[model samples]
Target chain A: MAEKLLNWDEVLIGGTIKDPGNSKQYETGSWRVERPVWNPDTCIQCMFCWVYCPDSAIKVDENGKMAGIDYTFCKGCGICVEQCPSKPKSLKMILESQAKGKTEEELRKEVFSSEK
Target chain B: MGKKVALTGNEAAAHAIRQINPDVIAAFPITPSTPIPQTVAQFIADGEMDTELVTVESEHSAMSACIGAAAAGGRVMTATSANGYALMWEMLYIASGMRLPIVMAVVARALSSPLNIHGDHSDIMGGRDTGWIQLISENSQEAYDNIIQAVKIAENKNVMTPALVAQDGFNTSHTIEIWELEEDKKVKEFIGEYQPLYPMLNTDEPVTHGAWAPPNWYFEHKMNQLRGLLDAKDVVEKVGKEFGDVFGRHYGLYETYKLDDAEYVIVAAGSVCGTTKDVIDTLRENGVKAGLLKIRLFRPFPYKELADTLQSAKAIAVLDRVSPAGAQGGPLFTEIRSALYDTQTRAPIVNYTYGLGGRDTQPRHINSVFETLKRIVETGKVEKQFDCLNLRGEWR
Candidate 1:
C-alpha cells in the first residue's frame, strides 16, 4: 500500500482545512513582543541579555549587578529570556500589562508641576 | 439604486480610481499591494479606465513617474507596500518637499526580515517622518473614499503635499467586503479637474523644476515646504467637511468611540481599530467604562486633538503594529508621548505591541486589551508593555 501525500496547495487554497497559522493568511509584522524581563536568581551575570537586547533595555548597575530591564525601550522580544544561560533562566518576557497607567491629564500635571 | 459589490480593499481602491479617471497610473508591484496595480491594469485593459498605466521597475521609479506625470499637469496615482515603501523613501520626502499633489495608495505591509509580506504598520510608520499627509483606513470603504479624497486634499491650493492613504495588507487589502461605489459624475464633481501650479511640459511657460538650491536660498525653499504642510491642517479640515457634505460620510483627524464618561481607553490606527471598537462595545455592555481612539491622520499627527481627546481618561493603552528595534518603543508610541508632552492632559498611556508580521488581531483580543486598560486604571500599575494578542507557538 502507498502512503498518502498531503497537497500543500489544496490545504492552503482549497479551503478544505485552513491553517490559521498559514503565512499567506495575514499581513506581515502583526505579532510583535515589545519587552523582555530579567530575574536575578537565574542570572549568571554573563551580560548576554544586555548584549543581545536590540533596544538596550537591559542595564547593569554600578556594582555590576544586572539592574533591571527598561520597559520604555524594550519591545518584549523575550530575546534576553532566550539568551539567559542560568539554570533557572534569569531573564523572562513581560507582557505590556506590567506598566503603570498614567492619564494624559495626569502626565500633563506632572510636567507642569515639575516645571514649577 | 446602491448595489453591493464584494471586493478586497485593494480592489475597491482600484474601483475608486476607475471612477476618478486619472490620466496616469504608475506603480511597482509589492506584496500586499500587488493586487491593486493588477486590478487597475485589468480595469484599463477592459477599457473601464481610460488612463496610461505605467508599470515601473521599482517603487522609487513609481513615485518618480507619478511626480513626472503630475508635474506635466496630469492627474496621477500609484501604490506600494513595505520594503517597496522603504525603497521609495527618498522620493516620498521629495514628493512632499516639491509640493507635488501626488496621490499614493500605501498598502500597509511589515518591514522585512524574518521577512514577511502580511500586514503591519512598519511601512507607513517608517514613512511617518516623511512630510506626506498620511491617512489610515479602517476598512475597504474608507480605503476607496480616502484615495479619492487624497487627490482633492493634495491638489488643494492650500495643501500641496503628496498624500499617503494607508490600508493594512492582507487584513484589509485582501479581505472581501461589500462596498458602495460612488457615481462617476459625483466623484468627478467632488474631486474636480487637476489644475497644475506649474506645467513643466508647457511650451508657453518655460520653468525649471527640481532645481538644485544654493546654500543661500536652501533654507527658504525648505521653509516653504514646512509652511505648506502646516497650512495643510486647515485644508484637510475644509476638504473633509466638503467631502462629507457631498457624500454623507464625514471623517476627522482622529475619531473617538464610546468615550463619553469613560475612564479608560485604547488608541490605535488602521483596521485593528475596528476590532477595538467592537471590544469597546462589549466592554460597555459589561459596564466597563472604556473607549477607543482611532487615529486616521498619522503625519500631521493631530497632536492637539489627541491630547484633548485622551485628557479625561484615567489610563490609555496606545497600540502600535511596528516595533522600533533600537528605540525601546514603538514609533507611534514615542510620537504620542511627545505629542502629549506639554499638555495638561496626562494619562498613564501603556504601549501595547501586537499584530506584527500579519498576526491575527481578533475582537476578543481587542476586548482583552480594554480589559487590561481597565485593570491599569483601577490598579494604578501596568506591566508597561503588553503583546495584545498573538499566535500559539508553532513547531518549526
Candidate 2:
C-alpha cells in the first residue's frame, strides 16, 4: 500500500512529461522573442533605440554609444531594430532561445541583487 | 493574525469572497477565471469558508443561479471571463433591471476568433451598456479589496444595482503576488449581515419576482436602475473610505500618477495602468512630462472627476483595449471627449486602440504612445485615431 501511494505521487508529479514534439505544452512558446543586435556604424544616435525598447534592454554608455542589450530584461520585441532610422540600419534582431528554467522566486532575487 | 500567503489574483478574489462569507457562490470554470471557483471550492472543502458552492454547467446558468440566490435574500457572488461573460449577456441585463445587487468579478479577457485566452478589456467593454456598475482593478491586491468593497457598494440601500469588478484576465488573474488578506471578523463587521428588500423565497412574505413590465412602467423601472447606478457613486466612495480606514488602503474613483504639471497624460484602465505608470516614471526621468490617469470606477462614468483631473493637460491620450464597431472612436475616447466637451478648459484628446485580443501591451508600447502624444502636442496636428505598436501591415 505504501509502495502504491509512492507510485501515485510519482505519477502525479513526474509521469506527465511527454515527448516535446507531441505535447500540448509545445504551444507554451507563444510569447517567445528573438534577440536584437545593434550596429553602431550606421547609428544616428537619435535615441529612438533607447525610447522604443519595451524592456529597457538597450543601454547607453558613458560616451553615449549604443551599448548592447541586456538579455535578462529584453523580451526581444525588435521595436528598436525595426524603428531604427539609420539608412544602413543601426539595430537588427534574430531569433535566439526561449526564456525558461527560472522560477519567479529566482527572478525576484536576481532583480533585487542587481543594484549591488 | 491570519497567515499571509502569496496568492494569484484568482486566489485573492476567492479569498476575498471567503472573507465576505457569501451565502451562495454560483460559478462556472472559464479560463483566466477558472482558478477562482476552484480555489473557492477548496476553501469550502477545507471548512475555512462556510458557504454553498454551487457548480453550474454554463455561464448563463451560473448567473441565473446568482440572481435566484440574490432574490432569495442570500448574499451571492459569481465570476467569469471573456466568452463566458458573453454567454451571460441576457442575465447580466436582467440582474441589473431587477436591482438584485449581485456582485460578480469579471476577469476581463479577449473575445474569440483566433481563440486567445489572454487578458483584454473586450469582455467588460462588451458589457459596457448593460447598465451594470463596472469597477476596474489594476493588480491582484486591488482585485481582492475591490471584491469586498463591491459587495458593500452594491448592497447599499441607496444603490442596489449589480456590480461587476473587472481585472485583467491572465495578466492580473494568474500572476502571483503578496496580498494583505482582511480578517474575516473585520470584513463581516465592515459589511454587515445581508438583508433583502423583498426576498422571493421568504415563507412569511413570499413575492413574485422578475415579472414582465408594460411600456408605461418599464421606463420607470429603468429609471430606478439609473437612479441606483448614479446613487452608487456616493456609496462606492463612502464604502471605499470606510474600508480604507479599517484596512489602511484607500481608493478613489480615479488615481492620477505624476499628473501635476504634466503636459501630456495617458488615461488607462485595468492592469495596463500598472505598465503605464512604469512608463510614466521613465518618461518623467527623461524630462518627457508624461503622466497617467487610471479610471477605477468606469460606470456612471466619473465624468466630473475625470474632467477636473485632465482639463489642464495640453493633450490627452485615451488608451482603450476595446473598439466600438462602426463608431467614430473607441468607447473611452468618446466618453472622455464628451465629458470635456462643454468645459472651457480642455485639451486636444487622442485615441489609441491597443492590446486588443490579448496582444501583449509592454511598457515600451506605452512609452511610444507617450512619444506620439508629445508629437501631437508639439505639432498641433490632430491625428484622427492611432494604432500604437501593432505588427506592421497586419491591419490590411
Candidate 3:
C-alpha cells in the first residue's frame, strides 16, 4: 500500500462507498493476531467449522466437504476450532509471529501434529 | 384558522408528524415516548396519514431503518425514550455523520437500574454530544411547535443534520394541556417538501454515504460536521422567527425571565421552567431579585447568549434533573460554569441535581433554590456545593 498525502476535508470524508459488500476491499485479516491451522487427516467430513465460523472463514468443496480456511478475510477468530467437535482438536490457533516467512504447507506441519 | 385543543405532549407531537406526512417512521415502543409513535401508527391505521411505518424489533433497528430511509432520499421520523435512545447509540452517530435530516421526538425519561418509568433528563442529556440539534420544550405546545420547526432546521441547506425535540417524560408526555394548534394546511406549508440533495437511486448521479473516514479524512468530516452544527444556530433562529411569524409564538435559543436586573438566578430546562417561572413571580412580589433562565435550544448550545444573560445575576443555581454521577457538577452546570470562565460574569455558580425518576419538582423546591442563591450572594461563598434537591438522604 502506497501512503499518499490528503487534505483535511478530503481525509474526513474518505472513500465511503454506498455500494454493499464493500468489506471485500477492507481485508479484516490484517487485524488477526492468531492464525488457524487445519489438520485434514483427522478432520471429519462434518461441516461444523463451516457452520460456526463467524466470518465464514472455513472454505468447503462443491460436495460440502471441508477444504481449508480463507485467510484473506478469516480474522482468525477461532470459532472453527471451538466447533470442530473432534477429541484432539483438528483445528487450532497458532501465533501469527511464527507464521512469518513460512509457506502455508510448512506452518501446518510445524505447529499442529496429526500423530498426537 | 387555528383551533384551541387539549392534548398531551406526545399526542401533539404525533399531530405534527401527521401534518408532515413523512415518507418513513421507524420506531419501537418505549415508555413515555411510546405514545408518539403509537398515536402516529393509529393515524396511519385510520387512514388519516399515509406513511410507511416500520415497526422495528428494537430501538437499534428503528434508527437503522430511519437511516436507510433518510439516506435513500426520504423524509424520516422516529421516537424513543431512555433505554430505547440508549440502544440507538451507534446509529445516532451514523445518522448525523451522514448528515441525514431525520427528526426524532424524545420523551425524556430516567435510565433504568432498579428500573423506574417516570420523567427525567438522563436520556437526552446522555446523547448531548451525538451531534444532533437538541430542542427542549416546557409543555405540549412547545413540543408541537419545536417538532414542526425541527423539520426546517434539520433540512436547512446549511445544516442537513438530524434533530431531536425533547420534553419531560410523564411530566409533559402524559399530562393534558390546552394548546392552540395551527391549521394542518398552514403547518404543512411551513415545512415544505424535503428535497434530498442526492438520493441513493439517482442513477444519473451516484452518491455514497456511511463510508469509513480514515484518520486524514475523519478529522475533516468531523470538523465539517462541527461547522454544520455551528451554522445550525443561525438556521434555528431563522426558522424560529419564521414559525413565530406564521403561528404567533416566538422562540429563541434560551428564554430569560426577569434576568435583566436579577441579583439571584436559577437556570433549568424542560417542564420545570414553568414551575420556576411561577416561583419567580412570587419572589419578585416579595422584593427578591430572582429570575429564571429556561433553555430551549440545547445543542449548538447558546454559550455566548447564555453567558451574557447570567452576567447580571450575582449568583446562579444551575438545576439539573439528571445526576452528574462523579463530575464537578451536573452537565448543564458544567457547561454554564465553563461558558462563564472567559466571560465578564464572575458570579458564584452552584450545582444541584433534582427530580430524578419522575420525582415532581414543585414551585416550593424551585423557590428554595432561589433562596439558596440569595444566601450565596450575601455571603459570597457557596455552601456545600453540588447537592441533590429534595432527596431523602440525611446528608441532603
Q: Which candidate ranks first by DockQ, i.e. highest?
A: 3
Per-model tally of clashing residue pairs: 48, 0, 6
Candidate 2 or 1, higher lDDT: 2
Candidate 2 structure quality by residue, lDDT tens digits, A1-116:
01222222122111111122222222322444665665554578898888887656677799876776666566678798788898766666555542256543344344334322
When 2 and 3 are scored with DockQ, the better candidate is 3
Error of 1 at B294 (Å): 0.3
Candidate 2, superposed: residue stretches over 4 Å from native: A1-116, B1-4, B394-396
Q: Model 3, A1-116: lDDT tens per residue?
A: 33455554444321335455555666778889998898887887788988888886778888888899888889988888888888777888898998888988898788675455
Task: Please give the C-alpha DockQ score of model 1.
Answer: 0.01
lDDT of 1 by residue, B1-396 (tens): 235789899998888888888999899998999988898899899998899999888989998898878767788888899999999999887787677888889999888888999999988988887889999999999999899888898888767788989999998999999887778789888999788777767767655566544454456566667666767777777778888888888877778898767788878899998888877777788888888888888877778878788778888778899875667468777777888888886677777778999998888777777777777777877665645456475211
Give candidate 1's iRMS in Å, 1 decimal: 26.2
Assess the local accuracy of residue B23 in candidate 1 as a C-alpha lDDT between 0 and 100. Answer: 92
Candidate 2 residue lDDT tens string, B1-396: 445679899988988888887999999999989998888899899999888989999999999999889878899999999999999999999898878889899999989877989888888988998889999999989998899999999988778889999999878898888878877898888889878777767666545667644354456566667877888898888888998898888988888899888888999898899899998888888988888889999997989888888877898989888865667677888898888986876577887788877788888889878887888888988765656456456332
How many Å off is the CA of B173 in candidate 1? 0.7
lDDT agreement of model 3 with the native: 0.88
Report lDDT per candidate.
0.77, 0.80, 0.88
In candidate 3, how many clashes are counted? 6
Model 1: residues with Cα > 4 Å off, grouped in runs: A1-116, B385-388, B391-396
| Span of ten consecutive residues with least summed lDDT in model 2 chain B | B387-396
